[model samples]
Target: MTFALGPRAAKAGYGLVAFDQAGSTNAEALASARRGDTRRSWFVTSEQTAGRGRRQRPWIAPRGNLASSVLEVLSVAPAVAATLGFAAGLAIETALRQVSLEAALRSGGRASFALKWPNDVLADGRKIVGMLLEAEQVAGGLAVVAGIGTNVVAAPPDIPTPAVSLADLGVQVTAEDLFSALSDAWVEYFGIWNEGRGFGDIRKLWLERAAGLGQPVAIRSGHAIIEGIFDTIDEQGCMLVRTAEGRLEPITAGDVHFGSVASQGAV
Candidate 1:
């Protein structure tokens, strides 16, 4: 079956390639960028034999899940490019809402459908979507790949965190359908980002849909564990964890847990 984005992708100067199965879409997106294919493009697949989330942990998806990555070419510094993770997450949220996620929310289920910290979309505190940002230097500028995977038809089993899918919520959607919405939503969000000039807006909107805000959470970073209330994400996209001493520590990277029963992972 051939899946593709209609006119929105072409209007945005995007060229796309898809695979029936791949080890990882992020790897393919980066490779396409390195091969002198300059136009903005996306790599997509429905089945992934090997996928990875934060900390190189396994990210498994069924045949109907959406596995996609976009090759973003920007001239900004690495710090600025990193903020695109927020853009990607926001885009996915917007797309899903447009595709009737809001209607699904009213049906009453365990899934609340909200964005999790750093880069994840949670349904009733279980993760429905996750993203990984990968960056490297290409010839004239920086190349970043925002890899996203959504559990549309099926969620992976036996994971550290609780996972949910659209099907589980009684909302029917396919990987191709979600990707079509995502392609357009990504362009809209990218315009809102304005090459990182509009991060303030992104931060405000992201916090509004953020799950676990003002709630206690735990983060595991390197050899240490930090426990605190879920404070607002700062201007630079770092998570602010307000410790018991009332100090707000910035978390730029870590595996965050603490929101539902499936939380509390090993440090």
Candidate 2:
């Protein structure tokens, strides 16, 4: 099926590209960035044969799933650009909430959707979506690719954290349908980002929807594993963990696992 942009995405002049099959949507977006067309291009595919997530973990995309990436060139510093993950993460939560609400009405049980530390979306304690952010220094500024994968119809059964799909929750949605909602939600939340001026609000909303707050969580950074309270995500989007020694430490990058559900993972 030919993929078409929704009204909001089309009006924004986003360069929409879709493929029947691809290795990785993020790889495709990165290639487009190298060609100097990374203004607001979105690359999507139904199935990914070579997709990899943060820490180079393989992301297997079966036929019934959603995988897409958006590329944007920003003049902001790479440090500031790194926080865009929160914007994209919140957008996914918002978009998926709408879909889940519909499913809730049908199933007669409200499906709880939440944001995990760093940038992941969870539905009722199971990972329903994952995101990966990639960046490269370009001529004028930094080009960042926001890659998002949604478990629309199915999830990897053998993964560390349990995975759940929309279908598993009684919601039937197509990749095209989810992508359309995501594109529109992206525009909405990114506007709230307001060139990072509205990060405070974004942080507030993210924390409000966060999971495992005030709860014990474990993080594996490199060779060391640190267990602490899932304190908060600071304004700069760092995870603040209050260690058992009563010291509050901010983590810029690490893999987070909540309670006993955590497996060897990445953020």
Candidate 3:
């Protein structure tokens, strides 16, 4: 079936495009942007055959989940554009909270969710969502593709750690519902970001929902494993890790292992 944008999508202030299935929403959004589609838009897919993670790892894309990308043209510098990923992450977390709250109003249960530093969402300490943001410089501006995937009904089976789904938490959500919530949340989050907020508000919200703060963590970058105390996120959204030798390291990029201090692993 050919995918079409939802009726309420265009009203959200972005051109919305859909696909029945695709390799990756980010990839499709990038291709669309390269072909002169200038309007801020969203690229969504029901299934992704080759979805990717931050370090090019394969992101699982099961049916009956949320898989989409937001393509935005930014006049901000690369440093600021990079923080857009964190802003997107915050938006996703807010969207999940909205769904969870609605579910709670019906079921009388509390929402038990948290966000991993940078770009992962978790429920009961298991991953339920992942995000990937890609950016490229265009002629007069920058195009950013913010890709997000959430396990609404099914989580991937081959992950290195435990995973969870919204259904598993007794929350019945449709992909369309998630997309709607996400669109609303993104509008709010990006508005804050574009106003020169400089990630201060984003960092605060993320930290409130963040997991593993003040805990021991092992961050792997390439072949090096740096063990430190996960302190807090800095103004730029970098993880602040106080190493064992009294040095506070600002981690710009790495695969973080929560509560792990034994060995270093590939990031």
Q: Which candidate is the best by lDDT?
A: 1
Candidate 2: stretches off by over 4 Å: 105-110, 261-267
lDDT of 1 by residue, 111-219 (tens): 4568888999887778888999999899857898999999988988877677878888777767888898899889888888888999999999899999889987888
The top-ranked prediction according to TM-score is 2
Task: Name the 10 consecutive residues with the lowest summed lDDT in model 1.
Answer: 258-267
> How much lDDT does each candidate structure score?
0.84, 0.83, 0.80
Model 3 C-alpha lDDT per residue in residues 1-267, reported as the tens digit of each score: 343443444565678887778889999989888887868898887688899888788886878787989999878777788888877888888888888888778885445778887788888888888999888887647988889998888888878657888888888767778777888788888877773365788777778878889888888787877788889998777899998898999998887788633234323
Sort order, lDDT high to low: 1, 2, 3
Query: What are the RMSDs of all candidates, in order?
Result: 2.6, 2.5, 2.8
Which of candidates 1 and 2 is the stronger one according to TM-score? 2
Q: After superposition, how far is residue 103 of candidate 1 from its true place, in Å?
A: 7.3
TM-score of each: 0.92, 0.92, 0.90
Report the lDDT tens digits of candidate 2 across residue range 68-168.
Answer: 89888887877788888899999888888777676567665446889987777898899888899999977646888899999887898876578898888
* Model 3 residue 246 lDDT score: 80
**TM-score: model 3 vs. ground truth:** 0.90
